[model samples]
Structure formats: structure tokens, C-alpha cells
Target: MNTLEQRYQFISLLGQGGMGKVYLAEDTKLSRKKWAIKEIPLTGMQRKQVISEVEILTKLNHQHLPRIVDYYTDEQQQHIYVVMDYIEGTTLQEVLKQKGVMDWKDTLHYSLQICDVFIYLHHDLAEPIIYRDLKPSNIMITKQNEVKLIDFGIARSYNQEKQDDTIKLGTIGFAAPEQFLDGQSDHRTDLYTLGSLIYFAISGKRYDQHATTPLHHVAKVPQELSSIVQKLTKHDAGERYQSAAEVKHALYKLLNKHDNNKKEQSITPMNIGTVMISVIATHKGMGSTHTAMMVAHHLNKKGYKVALIEANKSNEFKYIEEDYDGKQHKEVQTSCFSMHGVTYYKCEPTIEIATVIRLQYDFIILDIGCDLNQAWMGEFRRSQLRLVVGSAATWKKQKILDFVQQYEKEETKDWVYCIPFAESDQMLEIKSELRSKRMYAVPSNPYPMKLQEKTIAVFDEVLDHLPLNQKKKRLSIWWLLVPTSLVLAGIYVMMIVRM
Candidate 1:
């Protein structure tokens, strides 16, 4: 066991990859932190690809994920290793193969928690996140059965992918329908995989009788957990959970519903009320930021105490090309963030959103930064609502709807509401589609253009455009759900909690 601070510190090869090797290293700095360094073979294009991979992982941090502590090159082979929280635990696949399926309760408990991890990664972020792969080998379970999902080599910052890809990429047993067809994926694809994992948990199989028709197969799940899993695994995005928060809620409900009299665990649960939060999402440059600013401006003009939280990196260090007094000035820092004369807060990673609730603001418009790994995004789940923004084009509308449905189903959460950003023609199509799906009052046609304006300014017009008494999914402090719901296909709910 040689210990040195060199690049090849104690070359005990932990694992070998096609790209290169994973070495177990003793970090000389930072208290000799143990890191699993992934070294990519240095070739012509390999170097560039390695660089891009490192950039993607360097900025990511989540409770269920490993953080990238360091990245650099050592010797001829480019060293691109991510310093992760070394898990001495065995991979779930290994555990299952060696130890066999544990007690049903234990298996269910573990699988449900794993669902939480994906839920957090997807809807919990300001920008939607997508975990393209879900399988036993990729999941790790500790001695205490805590799940830590790893291997983001192919993950993207997204919650959903609308329209299947022409080609599919996933392990045969675990891939979803859309994945196999190269169709669109979103938050729901991960849920489908999750449902499959749970199927392995409750029963001794990886998939149910009709795994493809998950919504129909949902009734086989045990208790209220069935609702959560069915919704998450719906074949069509329209019938699924819309966000990770919703999934969390379903988990909470299933977990507590049974033991209403049981004592609850330690919780300084987020104090949230009235104050709403919505993220305007679209392909970058679709003017979502502008829409958010417009809504905020309109809300402010209506005598409402509103706050617009910007997750966009551009919000800070923004550039303004101005002809101030006929002199061309590029990149000017201006206070143009306030949505339509409304008071807004330009924020960073660790934000105090509780203050907004305490202030009793009637509304808050947030620019859900498309950039993944935002600091303030985790806090937005405490908000009263979410507004998804996309153009009225059929493709865009379908994408948004697909995302919401997937997120909701996979997470088993009900959205406060969904409002699509549309153009006039798209709005007509959207209206017809919404009616067909039994979802009414699809957002207004071409609400208002605030391209050169802030996104919050359009809040007022969007609000009025909301249909009479929007559909709201009632929330519970602790959403306790069962895990066998998918297997049993029943909406059984009971609580065992501190009442």
C-alpha cells in the first residue's frame, strides 16, 4: 500500500473502463481524500471528449450523487477522475445476486427511497433533469440500505424527453418503450425504470406482467403506492406525475398514510404557503426569460408583493448593448431585471426563500435557470405553484405536456397548474389538444412579447389567462405511499405517523 501525492498515487486499480482506468487514490491534500479517478485514454479526439465530460460533472452536486472534487491531467493518459463520496457499500445488483431478495418490507423500503433520488434529480432542480439509465448495477445500497445512484456518464440536465429517439440505448430489461424506439424521454422514462426496479423488489421479477402498459398495470401495486407508481409509469406522459415534488408527495403519503398514530421522524420541514414559484422552461433563446419578466411586471402593477428569482447565469453579469446618448456601449450591468416596475431579487445558490413567504408576497415569478446544479432550485419546491413555459408550436406544447405528465407520474405529484407559452396558431392547436385530453383552459395565445423586457412583466396577463379556479393538487405535510402498489394494482393508503 504505497502512499504518495503523485498522480498515480498508489496505483491499486479500482476498476478498468474502455476510456481508461479507475484508480483508488489517496489525496495528499484535503486530508488525504480517497477518490475514484477515471483516466481517459489521451488520443486525438479523446482529449477533447474527456474535457467535455469533466466540464459536465465538475459543476454537479446533489445528496444522492457524488461530487467532483478534482480534475486534471497526469502523464500521457489524461486523468479525468471525479472525486466522489467513496461508498464502501456493494452495488444493489451484487447484493441481490449474492444475498437474494431481502424481506419484502426491506426491499420495498429501499426501492421507494431510490425513487426519491431520481425525483430529486429531475423536478427538484430549477431546470429539468434526465437520468437516461436506471438499473440495479448503476444503483448502490449501503449497509443501512441508503441508496446512492451513480454513473452519470450519459446523464443530461433534463426532466423529460418528448418524442422517442429513432434509436434506443439502455439495458434490455430496464429500458422504457420510448427509449427502445428512440422516442422522446423526460422525467417519466426514469420512473418507468423505477417502476421496473420496484417490480423486482415486491415480486422476484424485474418487470410486471404488462410493464409496457404501466398505467393499466398500476392497479396491481399495493396500497396508495399503486397510484404513485402507476402515475409515474404511465405509458402516455399525459397521465403521469408532473414533477419530482409530486413524487415526493406520493412517497410521503404512502409512507405515512398507514400509521397516522406512529411518531414521525425529525423534520424542520420547509415552511411554505401562499407564495408561488414557477419556472419558465424552453429551448434556450425561446424568450422564456422575457415571459417571466413580463408576468412579474404585470403582477407588480396589480399591487401585489412579488419577487422574481433568476436562475439564469446571464441574470448576473448580463450584457446590455446600448446607444446611451448615441455612444455604443456593449455589456452594461443594468437594473432592468425588475419585472415591469416590480421589485424582484436577483439571487444565487443558497437563497433565503422563507423570507419571501414571511413577507406574504401574493406571487413570485422565478426564471428557472436552464443551467443545471443551481443553488436556489431546491428551495423552489416549497413554492405554491409551478409555471412551465414553452412556445405554442405543436412540438413545443407536446414537449411541455410530456414533461409535466412524466414528472408528475414518475414523482406521483399533482401540479398546482401548467401554463404553456404559445403563439396564436399554436394556441388554437393547444386548446383543441387540451380539450381532447380533458385538460381545459390551455394558456392564452401569444400572451405578450417581452423579449427586450423582463420575464416577470408578463405575470399579470398570464394570471388573468388562468382558467376559473385552476386545478390544484391538494398537498399533505407528509405524503406516505406504499411500494407494492404497482404489483398489487390497488390504491391502498394508510398512515403510521405522529398525529
Candidate 2:
């Protein structure tokens, strides 16, 4: 075929299957943009099936799924052409062939990504979709290490009325037993395939049902990961993980366990002191104070002596004290208070951070607000971890870019960019542009004083590699009152009063 719809120019054939052919084509109508054109021959009855597939593909909007741009039927060619994003990457199968076997950590990373896609397909959609085929060949790993599920030819919507699949379709090794037994496949079927895929990814061996071999026997996989894989590959669908979310949670737990072990092993005697976290924002109203409070409370709950210091001249902490004390009058002044096991210090402009560091808190969270001026830059630079909270909105995105550009000269490995209320796609785009995985989406927390699971999870990932101070000591009430005297004594203070 020379060209289809007088727009897409065929460049080269990408691949061919029993269904049809996929070509790497360029859209002449859209500035010569590259796209994958799928040409599937259609019979009279098969046209309806192709139409249903097109409907499902076009409606999907996900970061891990390919976008379907256009579809058309060429009656003379007797084929339906579907246009989609040209994914530039190597298949997982090719990677396995080149490397022989993958590291267990890499396998777990890709598995978690696949679980995210599965969760979106199974639970996030209006009608659940069960991916009937899942194998290394079907999974694509981008240059940036992002996982993308390429083909959806055999994917079908879940139907409670049907007891069995009308058409049984799946690969031999990766397909669950139910797929070939005339039994209906559900979300659990995909989980089973994920198990098989994980096994092959780590060991470079196909999973066999008849002569079952434990993953640990073939590969040096972690015990937790092996247990999760075993549970996922159970012969009975009921015995397997019920949903992709469950599998994801299990994988995350395993990852955390591995990370905690590494942290413990890497800890040294010199690094066992107090760790400071500085929280700042690109601009005002970007949730710096809220993010600091959330982290402080979370660390406090984890049995750390967490002190939230107002490192900037913001009234956020003073307001928080007033609100907590049930005093509506603005005349009430409390420079220091303790709530929820976290000590809050409302520092004055002359308060010195060195003095606070001498107090020996396990974790000192400096809420610097949006003040990136030289006055607060010293404290921000001294912190072990620096969190820059910024808006993810399109108009406000430039603020974050500007902030990064200003600090480009400094070492940024300790810096983390946080966008509040950011969607998955937004976070992915920003992360790609920034070329940093330290970026995280801060979940919405209406009550910063209370701990939320989602928010805590973000912090868990952020602080996973950091060594925690094992020497835990409770904060005394006298230590809280010391900040009040320091502020009144006209010493350097980082006065933080709530908005």
C-alpha cells in the first residue's frame, strides 16, 4: 500500500500476525508525524468485531496505553486501518534475549508498572477489561524505562452473564489454566499472567503448570517476591490475587522490605545523627506549609522526635497554634506547642537554626514557605532533603521550571519536586521533562494535622533510602518552651505563623 486516506505514507512494515500487519507510517497531514498503522483485513462478519475493538481503543486515555488517533475502512483494499501512537522502544522479549536474565529489582519495577496498567484496565474503566494475552512480547519497555502494554487484540470486556469466554485466546505458558479450560477469565486471569511474566523475566524460563518449579529454585529472587509470585500463579483462580491492586501492594511491600534492608546495611556511625528536611515552594499558595506539616506528622507517628520549625517569616505556625488551642482571637501568641506527638516551633526572624539543631531532634522539618531568598537559602541548603512544592497546572508549571533553573548551579540530588493534586499523566510528563524520578505527586489532604495513607506512601518512597536515627528519644516539654525563650531573647528565629 502506498498511502491510506491520502494522509499516512507507509514507511515500513513493523510486524505481521494472523490478524493483519502493523506498519511504521508517517502522517503527511500532521507535519510528518510518525504513527503505527494497523491494517487488518475484514470479512463481512469481522467488520463488526473490528468496529468494537476500535471503539474500545479510542475511548482509552492512559499514560501506559497507546493512543488511537484515527480509524478508517478501505472497501477497495478490504481492510480496516487503525492509527495509533508509534511507541519507540524495545519489547521485553528482546531485552530478555539480549540480557539472558533480568535483575530481580528490575523485574519487580516492571511488574509494578504492569500492575498499574492492569488496575486501570480492570477497575478504573467504566466496563472492566480482561487482558487475555500477557507475555514479554506484548510488553514494551521505553527508553526511559517506562512500561507500556502494546497490543489489545485479544482483550475483552468482562461480562457477568457469560460463564465462559466465547473465544479462547492466550499464549501457552503465560495464559492461566482457566483460559484453555473453557472457563471465564476475569481480573484474576491477568494477575496469573503477570506471575508467569515475572517468573520468565527474572529466570528466563517459562512457567509450566504440569512440572511446576518454584521461582526461588530457578532464580535468586527474594523470599517475599517469590511468595507473591506463588500466590499470583495459583492454579485456582479463587486462590490467586483477586485484583491487580492487591498484587501491586504486595510488590510494593517487597520493594520496601528490600529498601529497608539496604538502608540498614548502609548506615554508618557518623550518619546516625539528626536529619533535617527543608520544605519550600515555587511560589505562594503552593502548599509548602501543608506538605511540611504532613511530613512532620507522619515522621512523628513513626516514633521519631520530629520538630517542625518555621524557617521563614510566615504566620502559618502561629495560626495553627491558635486553631489548635481553640482561640479565635489573633491576640493569642504561642511561639511553641506540642500536638500529636510533634513539637511545633514558631520562630522569630532572629531565630538561629544552629541553636535548634543543638536541641537534638531526630528529624527537624523546616517549613521555609516560598522564600528562596538568601535569608532562608542557608537553612534550605543545610537540610538533608529539600522538597520543592509547586503547582502542576499548565499556567503555573513555568514557576517550577524557573525555580529549577535558578538552582541549576547547585547539586540537586537531595532536592525533590512535588506537585499537589497532580494526575498520573501530568506527573509522568513532568518527570520526563525534568528527567528526575525524585518528582512526586502530593495527594490531597484536607486535614494536614491528621495522617493519611496516600500522603504517607509518597513520603515513604521519598525517605526510603535515607538512614533513620535509631537513637530515639522523646521530646521534653522543656525543649518546646526553649524556643519561646530563644525568640523572646531576640536571637535569630525562623518565625512560622499560619495563614
Candidate 3:
């Protein structure tokens, strides 16, 4: 008997894959414990990858993941092997095949368990781990109905400091759009796969990554589940849930709603359209940055997706931009990121990119570094709101009035709002001097303060004026008028000819 045979007894072959063959084995020394033994033909590159996986596994201990029992490296024989707990039941792929499709309740149950493993892998560890490959075949369901993730061959610890691509590994229909590009894989990459898995479990159909319509439209999936899936699987990584914790939170909400049978509480998707607002400084000292930041944050708190943009040529946010991830937008020239509950972008003052940004967010807060000028006038005119900020100084107030009077059209006046930075007395003084009655005053606190009642009122006013996306009205039978008209014309001609 060989030395390897001394420790374990091979029962039978279970399965084989491109990388290795797995066998059913029993540990001879430990009460004949059942284990899975994977045998792989060593190639130099694959040998290094296997070693890396072992290093990662040594540090991981999770209920949902398989525990590493033993590993062997035989350089002379050009082969290597690993032993781990043999899951008692079948793979999710097999289960799906047998059952056709799982019920929403069961699917949600499995999805929540998967999220737990993801949170543990991405956050609990000292260094975040990116599960490069996540698919049905890699997951096993034990007799106890517990899920155990098996393959870690391609998983790697994510390097947040590095912005370049380190490695690319994923399965078709499960890989995020970033993996196919020069993009770095992070926590969001695994989120994309989770979305695809949920889609498959519910629809019993493979996900098409490029599909536009929501899952609810094509299948029996619920709208709430479908909406979350859409966000998770979005091609743009920034648009996806920021972290596994966030995804778990969303899933729990849906689970609670379903369990409570709150059918009437079902959410109707908001008709949020593109509403762009520009907050430009009337002078250098006026607080454009503070005003724009506050307003954007306020809207975000109201559940609107708002993006605060630094479009000024001076790039006033240079200090803030210094610490953001460098590899954020490798393909795109511009830098856009989400932080502290708000998305921020440093962009050139041009209409082209503004149009693109408008489509993605419900509102864009443009910090026109300085007073509005010709460079951004085109977009300013088209914007839903133009908020000009200035100090309480008479010169600045006059400048604001003159600017608005010259450029503000009679038809566009309703879209324009003004904010004056001042103290209690200064604000009242500015109101008397300023020509525009639509002006709102924001208190100047050298230190941070809560959103003031005046600021909230201003935001509420703005929201009231902005249009909401109404449910699209379906075409009625009235559209048949043209065909009916033609039919009547033909009948009249036939009658005339017969006469």
C-alpha cells in the first residue's frame, strides 16, 4: 500500500472537472470520516494558484464554507491533492434540475445564507476576499438544508490600494462587466453573481447580462425582488449596492414584507426623472461648496439618488479628491465616486457628460466653481433648477441680481432660486436689498450644523416643482381611428360605383 493509502481509503469517484478530479474517500485514522479528495495534475502556473488558495483557506473558518482537512504536494509525481468535508447532499445545480425551479420563499432563504457567507468573507477578515467564481455548481446543499461553498481555487484577497487588474476569473452569465475589462474585482464583483443566482432560482431561466427589462416583466418574480436584482447586476459597478451589508439589508426588507403578508404595503416605484440643479458661487468667497453639499445630502436623505458634481474649472474639491480610489474609472476619462451617502463627480463643464450623468441619477448638483458663464450656460438653461449662492455683501447681492436679470428668461425665472449666505440680521437685510423674491437664506455656521428649517423648506419647494415620472399610459383603442377611417372611405367608394 502507498503512503497516501495509509491515511485514507478511496471509496469511489464522484466527479471530474477541467482543473481536477474529486473522489469519495474515508479517513482511516479518524473513525472513517467521509471526506472529498481532489486530485490535480500539477502544472507550474496551476501549482502556484493552488498554493495561494491553501494560504487563504488556512485563515478562513466559516459555517457555510468547506473546512480544509488536508493537502498534499507531490513534486516528483507531478500531482497535488486536497481533502475537505464531503457535503451530504447535492449541488444547487442538481437540486434545480430536479425541482425545475425553487419557490420564492426557499430561494430567498438560500440567498440570505449566501449573503451571510459573503459578509464574512468580505468584511470579517482582516483583508477582504473576493470570491472570483460563484455559481450553482460550486455550492452544495447538505442534508440539513445548509449551503456550503466549495471552490476557492480562484478566490483572492482584494488589494484596495491597488487600482489595476490583478486576476480575472468568473463563469459565464455570472461575471460582472468589470471582470471582462481592465477593471479590478472588489466586493461588488461577487454581488453581481449573487444577483444572477437569485434570478436563476426564481425564473428557472438563465440570466442574460444585457437584458433591459426587469425580471418581473418576463417571469413571475416579484417587483421588489426584481428591482434589487436590477441594481445588483447593473453593468456600472458604482450603481450596484455598495457592500454586502447593504444587499443583506435590502433582502431582509423584502423578506419581512413577504412574511408579514403586507401585500398593500408593496412599493410603487417612484417616477424619478433627471432633475439637474446648478449651485454656483456669485463670488469667490461665497460658500458654493457648502451649499451644494448640503442640498445634495438633503435630497439623498429624502430617498432620491443625487450626484454632486464639481464642474468648476478650479476644481474646488481637489483636496477631497486626493484620497479616492485611483483605479475607479479606468476606461472612462472622468472620475466619479460614491462616499458618505452621496455620489460625487469631478467633471469638465460640458453638456455631453452632463447628459450622461443626468440619465443615471435623479438629481445632479453642479458646483459651478464660479458664477454661471458661457461654458455651462447651455446646460444651466436646460436645468430644472438654477440656484445662485452669494454672501450678504451689497456688491455680491447686486452682482447676483444683475446676472439673473440679464440671463434669466421670463419663462425660466420660475426655475431659478437664490441662496444668500448670511447671519440672522444680514439675511433680512439681504432680502430687502435683493431684487428676487424667490431668494432663500442659509445660515453661515463656521462649524457644522444640522439641516436648518429654511434649507428644508427650500428643498421642499424645489421638489414640488420638479416633474415626477408618471405611469406610462397604454395606447387605447382610439389608435384604431386611422384604419377605421380607411375602411369607411373604401365602403363609400364602393357604394358610389354601384350607383
The top-ranked prediction according to TM-score is 2
Estimate, for each residue in 402-458, the C-alpha lDDT of model 2 and write its tens digit.
878888888775689878999998888877776777998988899987868888888
User: What's model 2's TM-score?
Assistant: 0.56
- Candidate 2 contains a number of clashing pairs equal to 16
Regions of model 3 farther than 4 Å from truth: 1-5, 262-499
Minimum summed lDDT over a 10-residue window in model 3 is located at 325-334
Evaluated against the true structure, the overall lDDT of model 2 is: 0.79
Where in model 1 is the C-alpha error above 4 Å?
1-5, 8-11, 16-21, 40-50, 73-79, 102-108, 111-116, 124-127, 159-168, 207-223, 261-499
- lDDT, candidate 1, equals 0.53
User: By the TM-score metric, which is better: model 2 or model 3?
Assistant: 2
Whole-model Cα lDDT per candidate? 0.53, 0.79, 0.69
Q: Is candidate 1 or candidate 3 better by TM-score?
A: 3
Error of 2 at 442 (Å): 28
Q: Report how far residue 199 has shifted in candidate 3, in Å.
A: 0.7
Candidates in descending lDDT order: 2, 3, 1
